[model samples]
Every structure is written in structure tokens, then in C-alpha cells.
Target: MKIHLSYGKDGLDVEIPERNLAGVLSFGASTPLAHPEEAIARSLQEPIGSLPLGELATKAKSACIVVCDITRPVPNKQLLPPMLRTLEESGIARNKITILVATGLHRPSTAAELDLILGQSMVSKYRVVDHHASVPGEQSLLGETKRKTPVYIDKRYLEAELKITVGFIEPHLMAGFSGGRKMVAIGCAGEETIKTLHSPRVLDDERCREGSIDENPLHDELMEISRMAGHDFVLDVSLDANRNITGVYAGHPQEAHAVGVEAVRRSVRATLKEPADIVVTTSAGFPLDLTYYQSIKGMTAALPVLKKGGMLILAAECSEGLGSERFTAMATRFGTATEFDEWIHQHPVDIDQWQLQECLKAVRQGEVVVVASGIRPEHRDKLFVRTAASVEEAVAQGLQKFGSQTTIAVIPKGPYTLVEVSRTSA
Candidate 1:
């Protein structure tokens, strides 16, 4: 059987022997909007749980719109035009409207990346800036949440008379879902705020995993932070497998986000009858798999359907190699996942450790092998997991470990597809 996995820009095609194949796991079919641009316009006009965007803009002097960084495949070009036009037509000047990229703790988007994130025309026409979480002066203290997580948000966003966030709803590794308040709470947060939220105190809880919102402590904390920062409105969308707009949700932050989450939940979920002895997956391609740190999401997302001691194979482009200096240093420091996990528990939370912490979850579950061509030769041996030359070689190695008859499952879209086992293995 031949399977095309989401990898880089063009994707990857690999042939697997038919005898060992369990199934090709993928999202349930979802229809993309026939007229997405028109749908977006209508959504802003008849937004849920709040006044129309134009009316909200009419009452404000200055406005700020937050957008996700390059890591996420958010359709900023489509989401921004209607919003910017609405704010400008309602009296806010071009200069008064700022477009902030919610970069979180990641490196600032480069000039070329900014053009890719927001169109080049949009980048030049508006005051487009990346959030610098490390710069203290750029953030304002908004006190703390009920959980005592400190709230430090971008001053530009907090000071704006009208604040709006645009993102797409997807199953996040932590914080349950990725849209709504996350675009502000985490994206525009200061270094201290970002570190505190990602600390083990919040992420250690199992409820913080994907597809869990109501009981997710991280989600609750983010909502509290957004409210404290005065999150005014949100325009979030649900995307089909093709990355086409499937649903457009606008208006009140909480209400609109909740509606979008349900729509996404109904569409992207995939279930398996039993655990697989061997599983192959990807990091959902392009910008998502650009670095090894980001590729960890694909591993954790596949765990629910993987048997204990199963062989997990990942194919990520990792065009930028590992990740941030902090993440790269910490990731290669420990020889084993247990060593890393123990050290993180004893010391204070450092930048980017949470992702490694999540990565260790999959490591503990089973052996992991990666197929990445972009990594430097010297750095490849330093990885905690094993490395492979190609997807075929990785699968061949897995077959050697578990034998040729092992049941194999494949997740083509990786983290984007919410994979779960329906029943306990006998």
C-alpha cells in the first residue's frame, strides 16, 4: 500500500507492505466553505454574543488585532482583510490599527517570514510588528489569575480600545484547543507569563491534553488571563483537511471560540478499534514540521492509539533543524527521557522545557525513531531518539523490532487528526 504523509510543502509518499498494514488513519470528511470571503464578511456583521465588529470599532479610538506566528497555518490573508477594512471604515485610521504577531517565546518572525504570514502588501501597508516577550517594557502587568498565574500582556494590545484575535481552532498538544484566548494569553504574553503558563504545575495534569477543554487547567488559566487583559472580541475559523475555511466564528471571545471548537471536534476526530504495535505519523507538514521541537506534537498526538512498548516512527522535514537555542541545548543535554524529566522537576522551569517534557511522555510509552534530512550531521547523533535515513528504512527497522506480522497504523496528517482508540486492548 502507498501512503502520502503530510511533509514539507509537497508531502511524502511511501510504500508499505500490505500484509502488515492495519489502516490509514485520517480525519472524517469535512466540506470547505464555497464562499469563504463572503462568509467572513457576514460573520463580522452578525457576530455571536457581541455587537457587529463595525459597531465595536465605531466605539473605539485605537484597535489592535493579534495573529498567530508562522508556526501555525492560520489563513491570515483571508481573515485580516475583512477585519482591517471594518475597523478602518468605522473611523479608526490606518495608523491606529496595529497588527501584532503573537509570537509567544519563539524567535521573532524574520522579514521573509512576516511576508509569508501576512501578505507582503499587508505587511507594508500596516504597522505590523512581532511580539517580543523578552522585552519587559513592551508588556504590562495585569495582576494574576485565580490560579495565581501572573498576567503580563503586550501593552499595545491591552491599551487598545478594541482588541481582537484571529486564529483557527485545532487540537492543541496542551491547552486543549488552540484558538480563542490563546492568541492573546500565550501569543502576546511576556517571557515570565509564557514560562509560568508552560511550567509543569499546569501541564503535568493529564486533563491538559488534546480534545479536553472543560476540565483543562491550562485552558482555564488562559481564559482568565485573556479576560484580565481585556480580550474584547475574537474571529476564529475551523479549517478542513485541505486547510480551507470550513466554519467562520466571530464576536464574543468565549462564546465564539466554544462554537468553533465544537465544529472542529465534529470534523477532525478519528478513532481506532485497538492499539497498534507500530505507528507511523507526521507533524502536519510545512511550518509546523519546520523544527524538531515543533515536531514533538506529532508524537504525543499519536500516543492514545499506540500500544505500550510499540514502535513509533515520525517523518518531519525540520527544515530549520532542532529549535531555539534553549530548547536545543536542553533537548540534547540528557541522554534519556527519564533523566530529562527528573531534572526538570528539581530545577526551576526554563524556557522551552515543557515541549521536551511532553516529548518524554511519548518516549516513556515506547521507542521512537525520527526521519529528518535537514538536521546537521554533527547534531543528529545527539538526539535522545533514534534517527532514520528514510520512512521506508524507519518502517523496516520497526518491522525488525516487532516482527513482520505486527499490526501497523499510519496517521497521515499527524497532530491535525485527533486519533484515539475506542476500547481497551484485551
Candidate 2:
């Protein structure tokens, strides 16, 4: 197996045994392939002249903000500067513009972190505000959909004459990809709207497999409801394992997303056969590289394919503890997803019940779970799953259970965890 890495603009490949689960691991879009600065340059190189929204901004009479999703590793370097330049060229002054960090229910990015993400120039030039969806009451809805569902938008976004959303597209667990309707779900709306959009009416239905973009339940509705809201323009990019922009689409939300979706279909998704006896996976390295919360998406992608009581070996280096405070709080508070579902039904404040449930479910299904992570020994020992210090140890443990009958599924760097199905002739 050959594993490729990028330090700067250069690519370095490391080869390991095809059967060696120890060294050969393939990561997703979490890593950076194109240099961030260069990716930014490329996005800037795009001719924004054809876009209706860009044209609208060009002739705008007042100011509008460029609200870029800073969640995960959005190509912010490629996202902001050119947008500002374009908006500025359109007549909106840099000072009049604002950048909102759509934190939604996630932890807010610090000023230093924001500076690191948006670059010092934009940080110094314009107001960079973090959208606090923590307080649901503070948010406002733009209008009601035909279904009578209110299209909640960030109050600040409504403040501007034109609102622009920018984000990176990747295989997402709930909403298919990140960019399409994510802005409406997490960026514009309050928690109530978020929950409403994602609640039982949205979840508790037939779910699409993690890598199944077209079939995913949440992804289906998000697209419908987002179009209801007047999302002016959208810019989304499909990135490779190294966070390199493999594709970029900018236009009316659906059109742009369709273009991006088509590209992602060719490049990202993989299919697998079901019912593996032993599954080994890494924490979808990079953004999910260092955190337990972010890494859980890999497990969600991997789990449904496992047979009953099948062992799942998770290799996540959760060095940053849990990524978000709320993620940690919910993971520990509820014993199962059903319990969280019931709890959310009663509470009615949080946005992601399905997320809470999956974590708890994963925790409770410890009989089938094994963790070979960078977490401390004491912590690993205490976690619900059986813990191994290294990959060889994890695989060896699985071998003990099945001897030769065990079928091993290896997903190195495991977001969009792929399951392989093959009818090999005996």
C-alpha cells in the first residue's frame, strides 16, 4: 500500500504491505493537499463575473457580509480574501463587511484561532463576529416555507443587503456534504430552527448510509428547506484527503452544489460488502485527526456495516480531548441515543439529537468496539470499549476471537468509512 503525504506543495509517498493494517492507512479530505495560500489564490482566480450574486454585489447600493463557515477545515485561505476583494470591487467597503464564524452549537473559535483562519489582513480590516446559536431566542426567521416551517436566519445576516456563504464540501454524516444547505442549518438558524430541521420529523426516518449522499435522510430535507430560504449565493469546494480543492462550485445554492456533488461522486465515495467480522479504522485523520468528537463521524460511517456483535477497532488519536464542550457533555450525560432522543424531546433546545444518540449507542455497544487510540491508558481503560495501545495489538485481539474465519475491514483514516462487498470465488 502506498500512502501519500504533502508537507508544502510537494507530495511524499510511503509504501507499506497491502495486508499490513499497521502502516497502510488512507486518509480523507482532512489533510491539506494544496497549500492553503495557493488554494486561496486559485479560488480568487475564479471569474466571479458570471455569478448573479456576484453581479448583484457589483451593483449593490449598500454593504453585505461574506459569512464563511469556519467549521472543520473550510478553505478559508481560499475563501475570504478574494471574496472581500470581489465585494470591495463591487462597491462594498471592507469596513462595512463582516465575517461570521457559524459556530452553531459548537465551541466558539478564539480570536487567535480566528486570526489564524481568516488571515490577519481580513481580521484587521473587518468585523469578525461569531454566530452564537447557543441562545436560540436571539435568532430570527426570514420567512415561513410552504410547509409552514420557518426559515430561520442569523439576524446579522439579514442585516446585510447581500449574504454570501462559503464552505468546503466533503462526505458529511448527516447532511451529505457540508456546503449545500449547511449554511441554513448551522449558520443562519437558531437552535430551535436547527432542532426543528433535524428533529424526529427530520431524523427517526430511514437513513442514508454515511457515504450515500443521495439517500441520506437529513441531506434530503436540508436541501429542500434551504432552497425555501432566500440563500443568495453559495460557494462550495470538494476537497481531497489533503484538503485540496478537487472541485469548486459557485452559484445559486442547488446549481453550485449539484456541480460539486457530481465531482465528489466520482472522487470521494467508495462501496463495500457488509457484515465484516472485524473492522479496523483510523479517526479520519486531520480535522478529525486530534479530537475524539470530530473523529466519531468515522465510526458513524463505519458502524452500520458491521454484523451483530462484530468487533469494531477504532484507531483515533484524540489528543485534543473532546473537540467541543457540548459534545463531551452529551456523550457522558446520556446512556443511549434513545435516551438522548427522549431527553431532547423533553428539552427542545439542542439541534443534533441523532448525533447524541449515535455517540451513546457506539459507547454502549462496547462488546463490538475496540479503541486503539492515542488517549491515555487510564482513560482508554475506563472507556466503554476495549482498548489496545497499538494496531498490531488490536488486530491480534480480533484474530483471537475468530482465528481464521474473521474477515477484516481496514479503513485507514476513517471518515466516510467504506465497506467493501465482493463475491470472491472459492
Candidate 3:
């Protein structure tokens, strides 16, 4: 079997294993990404036509708040050109438009980082500011949820006459899929409101154990919050392995986001359904494991498809594992979910963060586990059966222990595991 690789926009091709995967199964054969820019442009064109960003901005807009996806690698750099051009044509002047980095509790990106995501030219002209979640006064508490989660948000966003959200569509740790309403929900939402959703109780773990983004309650709530927030229009993007826009969905939040989901599902989802005894995989790449607060998706993908007591093999490069100090502190302060929640019952903070501690409890038992990543060996020992250097090695170890009769499932990226959930269910 031969796997092909190409660099700098040529295309990627992987020779399918000729040997009958008869009992063996591999889902996504590396295929060429043909006319990527054109594909993205076409998807975007439809929504651009509908919203007519230029026309709307030219009309009654006082101040425009352009909230950008400031998370890790997805800085909206590539899409910013055309999007800015549209805004300019639509009549919103550069000065009146304020660029917001919608980082909801994550550390704010620095000036150089912002320039990298939004290019030097654009960053120079537009007055941009990073959203501060820990700080007070700048952002206002819109309200609290039934669960008593507070919504800390960028006050400027609500005040703006026209609001434009830009982000890339990908798998999210909490949300089944990312983008569109996701921007308003987790991206720009306040800590309390987000906690109401992110907390283990509200998380859609068991609900979509074998379900897709469509059926997930987490995504459902995002849609609700986004609608109430009136995000107006969104430019949601989907990228290939190299972070190129393989698909772009633009328009009102609900309308075009589905396109992003399908495009990513094609390239990123697991192919086979039969339970695998030895599964070898990676984190599905970056942004998924940007930090542990964000790393759960990869685990979600492999968990459901494994047999009743099958072994799971994971290869994740969590170079920056557990990215948040608060997140790490929360994890260590409590021994169990019950204790964790009890702690939350008393102490008051911006967001109700105890829910994530609860979400962590679901994986304590079941089948055997194996992991090889940048995370500490102690952590691996605590979570998995073993850890190895490579996928082939992991598989070999698995076969030695579980026997060759076992199946194998591989996911290059864990974040997009939702695709496999539905396939496994089917």
C-alpha cells in the first residue's frame, strides 16, 4: 500500500490498499482536493448573494461589529480579504467597523498573533481588540440561564447596529459541530451562559453517543442562543488537512452552516462501523487539542464504535495539554464529579465551570484504553492500558494482546468523530 503526499496546493492522493480490506476496513482514502478555492467560493457565493453584505452595510448601519474566529490556527486570514472587500463595497467604512477576537475564556491573542490571523494590512487600518473574559467592566452580564449560568459577552456586539460573525466550521469539544450559531453560543457567549451548556449535565454526550451533529442537544441549544443573540449573518468556513478552505458557508446562521458540516464529514469522519479491537489514530490535528478544555472530541469519536470490552488505541500530540490554568485547577481541586459540583454550589465565578468536571466522569470505566501522546506517562497510566510511539506499533501491541481476529478503526482527527457516531449507529 502506498500513501501520496503533495505540498503547496498541488493536491493529495493516497493509493487505496489493494489487499482486500475484506475483514479489514479503512474509511477515508486520501483523495485529491480539486479546485478548493472554487469550491469554497461557490458555497460562499450563494449566501453572499442572499445577505448582500455590501448592500446591507451601505444602508442603515451605524457601527458594525465584525467578530472574528480568533481561536488557534483559524484566524480568518484567507477569508478576510474577500469578506472585507464585501464590507467595504457594502458601504461600512473601515473606521466604523471594529474587529473583535471572540475568545470566550481562552487567553487573548497578542498583536502579532492578530496580524497573522488578519494580515498586516487589514490589522493596520481596523481598530481591533481582544475580548477579555476574566476582566470586568468592558463586557456586561446580559443575563443568567435557568441553571444560573451568567452570560458574559462583548457589550459592543449587542450595541452594534449590524453584527457579522466569521469563523471556520469544524468539530467542537462541546458542540457536535462548530460555526454559525456556535459562534454566538460558545464563541461570543458569556461564561455563565456557556457554563450552562458546557457543564457535564447539559453536555450532549450520551444523547449522541452514536448520533451526529443534527441530533445533538448541544448543537440544538447553540441554535437557540444564536437566534436570541441575533447574530444576523455568518461566514462559516471548512478547511482541508492543510487548513485551506475546502468549503465555505456564508449567510444567516441557520441557512448555510449545514454545508460546512457535510464537507468536513466527507474528509474527516471514520469509514467503517464494525467494532475494532485495535484502533490506531491521531488527534485529527490541531485546534481539537489546542487544549484539553478542547480535546474531548477525539475521545468521543472512538468511544462509541468500540465493542463492549474492546481495546482503544489513541495517538494524540497534546503538546499543550490542559491549556487553561483555571481548567487544570478545576480538575485537581475535586476528586469526583459529585465533589466537583458541590464545590461549584458555593464558590461564585464568571462561568459555572463545574460541568466540565462532570463531563470528565463519563469515561472512567468500560473497555481497555491505550494512549501515546505528549501528555505525561502518569496521566496515560491513569487513563489507558498502555502507550506506544506509533500507530503501527500500537496496532501490533493490540494484536499481541487482543489477537488478529479483532477489527481496527482509524481516525486521523478526533474532533470530527460525530460523523462516525451516526455511521456506527447505522
Candidate 4:
């Protein structure tokens, strides 16, 4: 059987023998929108739970539109033009509108990346700036949540008379799902605010897992922060496996995001009859798999369908290497996975530590075999995982460890496809 997995830009297809396959887990197929631009315009015209964006823009002196950074697959190019036009048509001058890249704790997008993200026309025409989380003085402190998560958002985003956020809706490892409030709470938050949100205490909560919302404390707190940050409006899209926009949600951040979440839930949720002895997955490729830190999402997503002692074969290009210097430093500070866990339990204050801890949790589940061209031989040992030159070699290693009769499950879109073992099977 030939299984095609999402890899950098173009995708990767590997041939696996049918005899060893258990089942290929993937999201339900959804037809891509025939007219995404029209859909986006229509959605903005009749937004949920509020007046149309044009009407709202009329009252504004200035506007700040927050967009996802390079790490996300948000269709900024398609979404931004219509939004900018809406604001402009309402008499808001182009200079009064600023586009803020919600980098969170991630690095700033470069000039070429900015052009790719927002199109050269938009980038050159509009005043686009990257959020600097490290600069606390530049942020406005918007009180605390019930969980006492200090919400310090970018002053530009907070000070805007008209605040709008543009993002994609998808299952997230920590926030249940991404988009909406997340764009303000975490995306535009300062470094300390981000640390508080991703702290071990919050991340350890049971409800913090994927596809959960109603009772998710993390999600609830983020919403609280969003309210405090005064997130006026949001435009979120749901995409199919091929990155085509399938649905668009606009208007009130909470209301519109909920709609987008439901749409995404239908596309990505999958159920497995039983845990697999070996699970093969990818990090959704290209922009998302650019770094190992971001690629950890694939490992966490596989946990629900992975046997206690199963082997996880992860394929991520990671062309950007470790991605986070802090995360790599944390990994190097500990010798073993257990030590890493212990350290996190004691000192969970650092940025990106939570991700490393998640990586350690996956390590405790079983052995992790990684296949990536960018990872060096020396770095493999430091990452606490076995390295392979290709997915075929990793699968061969898994077969050797688990024996020929081992059940194998493949997740082609990785974190994009959420798999949960059926309760009956569990």
C-alpha cells in the first residue's frame, strides 16, 4: 500500500506492504470551497452575533489586525485583502490600519516570508509589523483571569479602536483548538503572559487535551484574556487536508470560533478500534514542520491511539533545526527523560519548557524514531530519540522491535487528524 504523508511543500509518499497495515487513519474528506474569496466577503458582510465589519469599521479611528505567524497555515493572503478593503471602504485610511503578526514567542517572519504570508501587494501597501513578546513595556496589562493568568497583550493590538483577528481553526495540542481568542490571548501576548498560559500547572490539566472545549480551563482562561484584551472581531477559516478553505467563520470571536471549531471537529476527528503497536505520523509538513519544537504536536496527537509500549515513527523536515534555543537548552540540561520530567515538575517557569516536557511525556510512552534530513547525527542523541534516514528505515526498525505481527496505524496528516481509541476498544 502506498501512503501519502504531508511533508515539506510538496508531500511524501511511501510504499508500505499491505500485510503489516492495520488501518490508515485520516479525516473525513470535505470538498474545498468553490469560491473562498466570495465566501470570505459574504461572511464579513453578515458576520455572526454582530454588525458587519464595514459598519463596525466606520466608527473606528484606527484598527489593528492580528494574523498568525509563519508557524500556522492560515490563509492570510486570501483573508487580508477583503478585510483591508472592508476597513478602507468604511473611510478608515490605509495608514490608520496596521497588520500585526502574532508571533507569540516564536521568531519574527522575514521579508520574504511576510510577502508569502500576506502577499507582496498587501505587505508593501500596508504597515505590517511583528509582535515582540520579549518587550514587556510595549504591552498593556489587561488584568488577570480566574486562573490568575496575567494578560499582557501588545499595546498596538489593545489600543486599536477596531480590533480584528484573522486565523485558521484547527485542533491544537494545548488550547483544544486554535483561532479566535487565541490570536489575542496568546498570539499577541507578551513573554510573561505566554509563559503563564503555557506553564506546567495549566498544561497538566486533563481538560487541556485536544478536541475539548466546554470544560477546558485553558480555553476558558484564554477566552477571559481575550475579553480583557477587547478582541472586537475575528475571521477564521477551516481547511481541508489539502489546505483548501472548506469553511469560514467571522464576527464575535467566541461565537465565530465555536462555529469554526465544530466545522474542524467534523473534518479531523477519527476513532480507532484499538491502540496500535506502531504508529507512523508526520507534522503536517512545510511551515508547521519547519522545526522540531513545532513538530512535537504530531507525537502528542498520536498518544491516544498509541499502545503503552508502542513505537512512534515521526517524520518532520525540521529544516529550521531545533526552532527554539530555550527548548533545546532544556533538552540538553537533562540526561534522561525521567530527569527531564522531574525538572519540569520542579521548575516550570521557562518559555518552551512545556513543549519539551510534552516531548518527554511521549518519550515515556515508548521509543520515538525520527526521520528528518535536517537533524544532525549528534543532535539526535541530544533529542533523546533514535534517528533514521527515511520513513522506510524507521518502519523497518519498528517492525524489528515489535515483530512481524505488530499492528500498524498511519496518520497521513499527523496532528491535523486527531485519533482517539474508541471507549469500547479501550
TM-score of 2: 0.80
Error of 2 at 375 (Å): 5.0
Ranking of all candidate structures by their TM-score, best first: 1, 4, 2, 3
Better of 1 and 3 by TM-score: 1
User: lDDT by residue for model 2 over 1-426, one digit each (tens)?
Assistant: 554422112322333234523222233344434455554444444423335444768766444344443336776766666777777787877767767777666666777778767888777878888887756555776665544456666677666676667776666666656675777656666766666665655554446445456667666656666665556667777677655666667766777777777666556545444556666665555545556666667666666545556677666656666556665565556544456657866775454345644454454443435453445554454433466665556667777876666666666646643443433322
For model 1, the run of ten residues with the poorest summed lDDT: 374-383
Over 4 Å off in model 3, which ranges?
1-49, 62-75, 144-150, 208-215, 262-269, 332-373, 376-397, 417-426
lDDT (Cα, tens digit) per residue for candidate 4, span 196-305: 88887888787888788879989998999998889889999999988899999999898999988988898888888888888989999988899888888888888888
Cα lDDT tens digits for candidate 1, 19-130: 9988888988898899999999999999999999999999999999999999998999999998999999999999999999999998989999999999899999999999
Q: Identify the superior model by lDDT, candidate 1 or candidate 4.
A: 1
Better of 2 and 4 by lDDT: 4
Q: Residue 353, candidate 3: how far off, in angstroms?
A: 5.8
lDDT of each: 0.91, 0.59, 0.57, 0.87
Which residue runs of candidate 1 sit more than 4 Å off their true CA positions? none
lDDT (tens digit, per residue) of candidate 3 on 1-426: 433222112322222223312122223443434765555455445574355555566764544445553344564656666766666667777777778777776777877767767888877888787766556666676665444556666676766767778787765655656677766666676655665676555653555342357667777777766666667667777665556555567777677777667776665665454555544444455544545445444555556555555555544555565556666555445554456556655665325363354244324332334343455654544331345665556556656776646566555444444434335542
